[model samples]
Target chain A: MFRDITIGQYLPGESFIHRLDPRTKILSVLFFMVGIFGLKHLYSYLFVLALTLTVILVARIPLGYLLKGLKPIFIILIFTVGLHLFLTPGQILVEIGPLSITLEGIMKASFMALRLIFLVLFASLLTLTTAPMSLTDGLEKLLAPFAKVGLPAHELAMMMSIALRFIPTLIDETDKIMKAQKARGADFESGNIWQRAKSMIPILVPLFVSAFRRADELAMAMEARCYRGSEGRTRMKQLVYRKTDLIVTLGMGSAMVAAFFFL
Target chain B: MIKIDNVIHTYKKHSDEEVQALCGISLDIQEGEFLVIIGHNGSGKSTLAKHLNTLLIPSEGQVLIDGLDSTDPDMVWNIRSRVGMVFQNPDNQLIATTVEDDVAFGCENLGIESGEIRARVDDALATVGMAGFGNKEPHYLSGGQKQRVAIAGVIAMRPKYLVLDEPTAMLDPRGRQEVMETIHRLNKEEGLTIVHITHYMEEASQADRVVVMEDGKIVAQGCPREIFSQVKLLKSLRMDVPPMTELASILNEAGLEVDKTLLTVEEMVDALC
Candidate 1:
């Protein structure tokens, strides 16, 4: 059940987007999100949407697989579009019972849905193309300048990588705990919200205990291999910006600029 | 060489109870020797394994990796890099998502250049029989594969000595055999001193020397033949002898002419036929 998470999952490939440097993708995604939020026109979003779809096509990510990631967010999409459809203050275009469907309402609802869709697509695109460790490494390099003001950038990156490493292990552990609790007649499902939350206490307590124990053991193991906190560390896969990264960055910048002015 | 000079390790529990985990444990580990340590639970075997790499400094004694003092704070990383450690839990010891990244963790910590780290990571992965598994994640690998990756991680640093604390305790028979074979190759081909801690008698029988621990002290230390010959004493110390050794002892008890110290199936077949 926990494997249903598709946000952080990577679809390994040898496509152009995959070959782009992780730092370029991470930075571009950040700017893209900010830029998308600032756009005010439908046509402006259409341009960005077309660009994102083209990138996804270049990345060779199957549409079916990409849309599978939106399953969990479908309800939120429906709620946002539904609220905007009837509550948007605009001229009425059609009458259905007391709820009048206006042209402006239709446009606003579609805009909201499009923004949400774009948000998820861009986020997933970044994750789909970049490996989690590469992403963390890019973040570390980007955040390195802040280390002078006591940012603990290396520590943060180390923690993120470790967390990424343990994600599967912890998920398996949770599944085991849930199974064991079920075997002992513990009802996790078929309960009210409060009851379900309370039922998680048993699983959480053991998970936390095992997590702390794992943390302690992992710390010792790291120390045994002479891990002294990234002070003098060097990566085997060094992050180097290639010509592809430069072109990708420039193209993305110009596209965002065009979208902003064209609106 | 590891000179564990009368190392006495003491730690206080959360209840404020002072526990003496190691009691003046001194053993001279020669360079390029495969030494197996066996004991029951809480026998200071793990505590001693931790000392070889300076994971835990001796509370009242000294552990010297080569000639450097492990207790000296400045030399901890130096000592550790020279004496790498692989712990029992395969899931916990891995520090990176991918096998190559985890293997390079040690070399990265040592600040080796990117080019050299890449070479060493590939070499280390190949040495552990995990060459093509560089891009694989830890969870996708079997228990043996994960443990081998952990071994690869340590060997990437090119340590002179490798200390393993119950590395096979969590593996199945096949997985355990895989790890044992890899370790034997490391000791023979790479010429790395091996300090292996395990309760498995078969693994101990393959060691060049066996050190038995009990109640925070070394109870016996000798060749596998000498250690397993005293089956009664080992059993009394809550240790299992190799199956062949036990069978040979039974044959000896039943008025048969058999060497009670025989530790392998071939030896038993020779004795019987």
Candidate 2:
């Protein structure tokens, strides 16, 4: 059950999209989002959808993964569609005794749903192709200018990378603690909501203690290696832009700009 | 060389019931020597191993690696770099998701260049027989493999001395063998000084020297043959002599001639049969 819940959702591959510089991919995703929100017409929405689908295909990621990414948003989608059909103000397309479905409401709801779906899909595409370390490194380089304005870009990126690296480790810890509690006959299921919540205390207490212990260990380990932060520290995989990065950025930039006028 | 000069450690000092974990323990460990330390729980063996790498400082004395004092603030990094530690829980010591990444953690902390880090990581894993496991996630690995990976992490740092604190206490029989073999290989082939603290009598039997601690004091120190031969002394200290030694003693009492320091099950069988 936990395996389905992918964190940061990185799908490993050697596709052209995966090989693009993380900086370019990040900027293009931002621009793609702009195109998503800029769609004021149905034609524009279609264009954005086409562009997103093309990128998804070129990424070589399965279509099912994108749909799975949307699973959590299903409730919101249903609620919005229901409110638009029953409560929105517009020319009524269908009438019952107390409920009327309006054409404008239908169009608005469809547009909203489509926009949200594309937004999530585009974000997934970006994460699917880039590794978490590369993403953080790219952010550090991109945010270098902000350091001049008093932002600790390197430190922030370092924090993010460390956090990313520990997610899987922490998840495994949680699983172990849960299993341990389960072995002790701590009832997690088959209880009232309050009882279940109380049952979590056992798991949480140990998890918290172990987490603190691990943080202490990692800190000591880091200090032992003489980690003094970014000062005088050089990385092995230095970030360098490639030709594909520029081409992808230019392609996406023009598409977004074109989306504004033509659609 | 590793030297401990009157190292004393106390826990919860300032409390009415303060505990003295180590009472002026001193020993000299030569370079590339395999030294096994055995003691009952709370005997200060763990505390002593922690001092080898500056994980804890002696309250009243000093620990020196190659003449650099562990208690000195400036040399803490140098001391730790020369003496790497692996703890009991393989789960806790392993900090990376992938086997290779976990091994590279020590190298990363040393701030080694990427190319050198990669090479050292591979070499470390290869030494532990985990060469192709660089990309495999740590959670999926067995207990023995996890411990080996932890050892690999320490080895990647290329320390002169390796200190393990009951590392096999958390493993099964198979895992225990895997880790013991790795430890032996590092000591013998790589010529690394090994200070291993364990409660297992079998593990200590093969050490170049065995040190027995009792109530924060060294009660006995000698080679395996010398230490295991003193069966009565070990039992008084609340430690079991090797099983073969016990069997040999019983056989000797029954008027049969046998070596009291037989270490392995195979050796015991050969002597009896």
Q: In terms of lDDT, which candidate is strongest?
A: 1
TM-score of 2: 0.89
lDDT of 2 by residue, B24-100 (tens): 99999999899999999989998898888777899988888999988788887778889988888776666544677
**TM-score, A chain, model 1:** 0.92
Residue-level lDDT tens digits of model 1 in A15-73: 98898888899878877876776788877877786888899899999998898888888
lDDT of each candidate versus the true structure: 0.89, 0.84
Model 2 residue B138 lDDT score: 72
| Per-residue lDDT of candidate 2, residues A111-209 (tens digit) | 878877888888888888987777887999989999999999988987786676667777777888889888888788878999889988998898889
Candidate 2 CAPRI category = acceptable
DockQ, all candidates in order: 0.87, 0.38
Report how far residue A127 has shifted in candidate 2, in Å: 2.9
Candidate 2 positional error at A71, Å: 1.4
